[model samples]
Target: MTDKLPGLHMRIPPQPITERSTPRPVQRPENAGAAFQEILKSKLETSTLKFSGHAQARLRLRNIQLDAEQLDKLEEAVDKAAAKGSRDTLVVMDGNAFVVSVRNRTVITVVDRASAKENVFTQIDSAVLTD
Candidate 1:
């Protein structure tokens, strides 16, 4: 007795493997390292802190303005927080408080001194006080 399932029999022919007649030589740019360095430098130079929509709104609502120097200091604070492996950080510069996400290099929110005094900050792993 032969046991077989009731189904159509489908068969496919096997393909033959073909070898290339001539092996292709690997090509590399002569100034690859220098090109990569240029790219890295440009990226580092252009990199800056980003503000979330909520943070922007808060800044506008509070009439808060950040000058070039203050923004630079805030970026430095975020870098320090990142070095310390902080995910969320509270950064206080001048009289303003900023909640930053170190990994994202973004300002999550902003609070003035008056509002900061009444609010309790949460979900932050570190705090940076910068001048």
Candidate 2:
């Protein structure tokens, strides 16, 4: 039986253990959380508004021009609509009406004051007036 297991009786020499070099200290920014928060805030503010192709074309065809302030208001309106769980919303700001898809944060169409006078807005769950 012992002769049949000759190869299984072989011994392996152990290697000496060496001390490992200490790892370098990881340097982290002191205000990393604050920096991340600031970046998130800026991104949220800048990416708030998005216009669809139809909305852009409607705006151009209607000769509607929205300045920075008006755009900010519209964005705020969309935010409010989203907060209230609105999927489709009608946002009226500065006499301009915008049909917004709250879930996508996109403007589907624009209606100027003149066109909005007697036009009916459909498929909207909520309306936000930012005037």
Per-residue lDDT over 3-53 for candidate 1, one digit per residue giving the tens place of the 0 to 100 score: 676795776999999996897897989999899978965664467999999
- Please identify model 2 stretches exceeding 4 Å from their true place: 1-46
Candidate 1: lDDT of 62? 96
Question: Mind giving the per-residue lDDT tens digits that candidate 2 earns over 1-131?
Answer: 54566567677999999999999998999999899978966765567788999999999999989899888889889878876889999998888899999888899999999988889999999999885
Error of 2 at 108 (Å): 0.1
TM per model? 0.66, 0.65
Clashing pairs in 1: none
Q: After superposition, how far is residue 88 of candidate 1 from its true place, in Å?
A: 0.7
lDDT of 1 at 2: 66
